[model samples]
Target: MSAKIRLYVDHLLGPGQSVELTREQAHYLFGVMRLAVGGHVALFNGKDGEWLAKVAEAGKKGGKLTCQTQSKPLHMPPDLWFLFAPIKKTRTDFIVEKAAEMGAARIMPVQTQFTNSERIRQDRLQAHAVEAAEQCGGTFVPEVADLQRLDRVLDDWPETRQMMFCDEAEVGSALRLAAQEKGQPWAILIGPEGGFSDRERARLSGLPYAHVVSLGPRILRADTAAVAALTMWQQALGDWL
Candidate 1:
């Protein structure tokens, strides 16, 4: 039977490679999951492709797994960054998890002028991204960046990367991107719950690479807008095509 458990590990994955599990991983596999020696598990390290591994040693504190063969090739997503202003605690986590599942190359949290939250637990959000990749059968996990000012991020934006700015003021505008060329680096930005200030909107509008678009006729909450924006971009210019 095929291994049903998929795990994201930090060690290298290759033929004949033995991976040492941490104490927490050991507890989850042995104590919680009831996996025993000789049981099979799927492993991925975000660099190497997924590998089918056999449990070589099972102990109370730690364990080891030996790689048997590569199960899947490393599939990298399009070079797309997901940028958004942090919202509530649970919703912020939701955004990070969904961004990982939806094929974002990187996840960035920006503090906008009207942003609700000032700081975020970067480690916790990153853990959510890893768990999301494991559950969604993805070989790559997007890195979650710490919260930064939106203005600063815009100032240092890459010249080659295009930005899809979801402007709340542009409500009722059709969400279209057919004119955009695919295969280029891109980013999708979702504003905070309170929406972007007039000054912020003006600054974004003046940018040469920013494509301001609306989600729909009505204003959407920050979390909902994030998912909607990702879906739209993926269908138009992302890997979903």
Candidate 2:
């Protein structure tokens, strides 16, 4: 039988396998969703494929589900990492949510010279990613990294991963990314509200793996830039192609 609800679980899923739900999850399903025993619920755990499960036991404090059949195989996203400076609380949450929905394999919050927020609740952001995956019909949930300085992150950059740096100063410049080869590791970097520092821009430009591009003829807000950059990359060299 098909289920209307899709849930992100933390347990293995296989034929006839029983899965235990956390109290919060139980509350969400039983209390909020009003799902009763024997009701069907689709489940996924990031690692395993999506499964159609039946609620075996439902309670206020906890619940259990039994996997009946595989609904869909795990479809992994491209090796794309999304890096951006955290803005206000709501906007940062919006960025994380969109990143997960847009097929980002990993989400990172970098601390730029002009970054407004120094600290970020990584756990909360991770939860946002999970919810985004659940709502957007994504089998994979991207990991949200803790806040780190931009320079330090660049210093340890992987040699093989290319970075798409969206430069605010290059508003009128052409977005030169269509020629980049696909099916390789890539990252999209969006600067903070105040934009990147001169040193940061210079360092990024000099990097062999960084491709600096302008979003358009105008400077976008940090959150808007992230979505624009992701859409551009996905269309050019990402899975959309």
Q: Each model's TM-score, in the order given?
A: 0.97, 0.98
For model 2, how does the per-residue alpha-carbon lDDT over 1-241 read when each residue is reduced to its tens digit? 7888999998999999999999999999999999999899999999888999999999888989999999989989999999999999999999999999889999999999999998999999999999999999888899999999999999999999999998888766655678878898999999998989999999999999998888887769887888888999999888885
- Model 1, TM vs. native: 0.97
Lowest summed-lDDT stretch of 10 residues in model 2?
170-179
In model 1, what lDDT does residue 105 have?
96
Which whole-number lDDT from 0 to 100 does residue 102 have in model 1? 91
Question: Which pairs clash in model 2?
Answer: none
Q: Indicate the worst ten consecutive residues by lDDT in candidate 1.
A: 171-180
lDDT of 1 by residue, 98-182 (tens): 9999999999999999998879999999999999999999999999999999999999999899999998889666546877898
lDDT of each: 0.92, 0.92
